[model samples]
Target: MKKINLKTTIIILSLIIISILFINNLRINKADNLSKAIVLKTNNSNVISSGVTNIGHQILTVKVLEGGHTDSKLKASNHFTGTAEIDNYYQEGDEILISIKEKQGKVTAVKAVDLYRQHWELLLFGLFVLILILYAGYTGLRALFSFVASVYIIWNILIPGLLAGQNPLLLSSFVLVLLTGIIIFSIAGFTRKGLAALAGTLSGLFITIVITIVFGNNMGLRGMTAPFSQTLLFSGHIDLNMKHIFYASIIIGASGAAMDIAMDIAASMEEIKLKKPDIEMKELIQSGFNVGRAVIGTMTTTLLLAYSGGYLTLLMLFVSKNTSLRRIINFKMVSAEILRTLTGSIGLVLVAPITALFAGWIYCSDFFIITWLKDLKSHLKFLRP
Candidate 1:
């Protein structure tokens, strides 16, 4: 067993302490109602004009008249006209400020000075990163860097390109290839292993893109099936072709699995070479195939599980409604997911053999073409001379 070095121990301890401190600071600075403000405005008209009001709820109505001098003064009104419960302590024309909460463009809650919810996800995220650094060490740091790069590329390049009316299928395909290169090479470094992974990942991703485009169109998977897609239309900001987005998403989502399979096969081949440098071409290729067979089974299932998990609630709703299998499967989102997951799985299967053949030919001694040609020439020249 390798002994723990002093540097590693200190780094681990420092990471733990930093994680605790950051978490504690996040808890201390959480939301409080003291930061809120309540204001009131008055309309002096004797005729009380009421907007839409629902029973069993309270409303705070503020009237701002045109060309009113009160705008500069931040006016507070003591006069309000509304029905209140008998037990509610308020005099007629008394100064009172009411709080209103709007949900989906309608008032839902009327409470005073409620504390805004503090989102703790960022703090939890920090702790998660710290934990990863402390435990996994160098590998964790590389994974983190890759994750950040993925986010940056997606947000800065892919999204902007989509919004600019670039062809979704083409842009997404290009982005996926770029991301695969960055992610695999950054994690694995520049080596034969990295090259093998890059080749496998690119081949698989291309296959996935082709499959998604063909099947997604045939299945009539509309992009509007995704949540908030209609909202983007209503907002008047996005003039997008929805079906193209659906096709793009299929390819983009599948690229992750492609990269995983490629990396796994490449890494396994690298390990094999390190262990048995003298392994022949046939055996080395077989070794890669063997490892790929084991990986593909789980990886295919992983794609299914990941894609299906998002729609479990929708599936349950369909089941409860006694929807027929034909109808359920015909749903746009369901069909899209099926195409995405299955197409990506197919890509993974193809990538394994493709990578194995290339890696074997490149790394194995017996199959090296240049070396073989050189030796053949040397033997033939003696006979000729």
Candidate 2:
């Protein structure tokens, strides 16, 4: 049996403890004012109710009673249109479970779903974790732990900080740096490779932020372009700057690509070092640049595809309406999407070269540059003497 290193063992233990704490925290602070209830029945019609607008969509005022172990009886009003598939699943008197929260003595069902109660997704997720642990062992466990940590950071730290009227850009930048450091170190360990990847990732992230901020402002991409941003306004969260939220989201979205490029460059450099440890510094730098060139194209397209996938329906809407190209691209949401995709692409492009340069310099520093130059000078001096 292979002996486990003390550092690796400690890391594994720390991650396991943190994972437990995070899950417990989430469970404890979960929204409890809301109750899950079944949809005993639903009333739907085209006529607009008093104080409600039809808005070209069907309206339903669902009547529900508390479900599960709670015996509490309650009535809730929920808005449903044909847009979501849940509306199609509803039949008169069908048993549908809805999550309802109380406000001012009235219960409002924010989200409702038919509960046949299948744990398939949960089961699959558990199986995935198990397979990862079984095959990859400690590293797999670390990856899972890092993933959990990332989610916690985003939800518990970043979201709350942004909503609490903190500077969105500043808070997001800080979170990105913290998350990158934690994730890289957790997965790659505190080694030269991890440091190289971290440097590249941070560099890419900074460039992404700069590009996002400049163009986001010039393009008039309001933060309200994001889903639920306007709802936050009406929901009485004051002093929350929507524009800053958009800026933060841009960097967060770009960070994944930045990390990818950094890792790619660092990994390539590490391989080159292993194969030829005596490779010249200039040659190693060139090798990293070459690898980066190959990655930049597809990675930028990946960003484009990712951002575009979310807006396919919106694009179709514009086309179906016969909207002009200029107008379609100029729409607030469309413009925001464009800015996000392009800004991320720019970061990816710059990150390739920056990461390659840094990885080359750090990985081959001793023999490739300094030692080679010193040897050359000594040879010349001996010849002169």
Candidate 3:
């Protein structure tokens, strides 16, 4: 009883420490220049068209919704860049993100930054949490906690380390380990199921890293194929290794799916073991392998479908252009997606077997020795007959 209590205490303390670190790492920088405002009025009479694009400055009357400038009405200007991708079209009653310039604690100027979407974002998030808790109950709640931890690790540890010019693979590997352990143990507890899942995820991810590095080098494409990667490179991070970062992204992207496969195998095997306490090691292993085989078939296809779906527009473009299969496959963007899909699928395939192997051994070890002896004696008696 004492031992159990001590173990519980240790677990609780460790969780507390991790929570503190996660909070500190995810600290948001409060910007004094930023404020939320509602677009009260917009004038488009002076707008002019340039070629196929609108190139005019929009004048707006915005009422501040936050800060000391609350309820203050100010005139704001939004210039059209003739680029639809970078511009926001605001209507009255639309909440917007804005930057305020102040002189001696008085607002002198304001500029619209973006359409404020936080209210809907929060509403959706709350609905999601509510649905998850209601459906999966405690397990869903635990999953939510893991989800939060993941956001913090990615935003804080992974992003900052990469920005600081740290070795991308190393930093990403550290992040992977942290996330794998936390996410798996948090959901599965510190039992054999969690251990098996963690070990399998790390091992599979390690293999993924190797495959990505080797294939990425020979692919003859810079990691700039990713959206915003080019922008990021030119945005004062010229020293960062975009290739390694891309490799890291592949691992990170595949990790969630890999964990799913591992958990499936581990959890299935764990249930099997609980039901059949005296199950032989060989039988248990075979059961795990069977479960792995079944899961991997769909899981690999699932990965492919997921990657392909995300690039549906690109695929549509290829179809519309009637591009040859060879040419389509050779395109850098298509090739990158292929690599990501195949590499992730390959890792997931391995994770199932690896997790099954470990879970079978760990779960069966305690009972297997005795079970094996009894089987051996019974077989000997049969031989004597």
Candidate 4:
């Protein structure tokens, strides 16, 4: 086995420690008044009152698993009906989530929130981590760390900032920059290739932002078209500009594909340079273009399919309703999807050439200089001849 580099070991260890601390702190600081309970018995025939629609109750026998009632050995249960059933229908032996209302350390009321499936969800995530590490080794570890960091930043910073009425465009742009730097540098390492990729990605992101800002409004897109956006406003974020959020989402969404193209081209160019140090600048640039061509072909379709895939049901609904093509195209949801896909694809298209240029300049600079001197020498010799 190859010996691990000391620097790499230290970096990985530090990142692991930081991740652990961050996750722990997040859990500790999470302001939620909830507890877990396991259902022992369920009775649906309990009628405490009569109503117009024959309102009944479900008395559930449960045992508290954690939180404020953890110390109580006696079993407990809560009666729920009506709107609570819309949240969940419980069964015996099922784990549930609950919140209790207490007065002077005595429980006044208990509400069953929903079913608990976090254990299986966490297990699935563990499997994903294991598969990633096994498949990609050190690179997978770096990718996982970046993923965690991205999630943490979004949850802790971006969400809170947006809720606090910060400018979504500016905040999202700053986040994109941070994510771009972290993802590229972490995956590619702090090398010339990484820098070239970062530069290319940022350039592509700039183009995406400009294009989105200029055309997104004309496309008649609003953040409210996004799922839960209206709910966000209704839930006390009235100060948020749904339009600006929509535009910012476009840029941020496109940035991932742009980064992919940039890294591909930059890495290709770096490899070509290392393999053929005597290659001319023009040849290196051409090689980068070739690499970009191959990447963008699939990547463009990837963005389109990804954006449209989620709206398959909506498309089917329109088709069933016999919606006209023109109307469908101009529909708010459809238009928003079109704008997102096109803008992201456009940014991805630009990433190739930008990355090619940056990589050629960074990786082939020495050879370019040498090629220039040789051309000058040949020109002088031709003049003499």
Q: Which candidate comes out best when scored by lDDT?
A: 3
Pairs of residues clashing in candidate 3: none
Give candidate 1's whole-model lDDT: 0.67
Mind sharing the TM-score for model 2?
A: 0.78
The residue-by-residue lDDT of candidate 1 on 62-156, one tens digit each, is 32222222222233223333533221222223333334344676545434322222335568778888998798776676566566667767866
Q: Quote the lDDT for 99 in model 4.
A: 74
| Per-residue lDDT of 29 in model 3 | 54
Cα RMSD of all models vs. native, in order, equals 13.2, 8.5, 7.9, 8.2
lDDT by residue (tens digit), candidate 3, 135-202 = 98657766777887787778878888999999999999999999999899778765667878898999
Which residue ranges in model 4 land beyond 4 Å of their true spot? 1-4, 45-59, 71-86, 366-385
Error of 4 at 195 (Å): 0.9
Q: RMSD to the native, candidate 3?
A: 7.9
lDDT of 4 at 210: 89
**TM-score of each model, in listed order:** 0.66, 0.78, 0.86, 0.85
Better of 1 and 3 by lDDT: 3
TM-score of 4: 0.85
Two-way lDDT contest, 2 vs 3, winner: 3
Residue 60 miss distance in model 1 (angstroms): 9.3
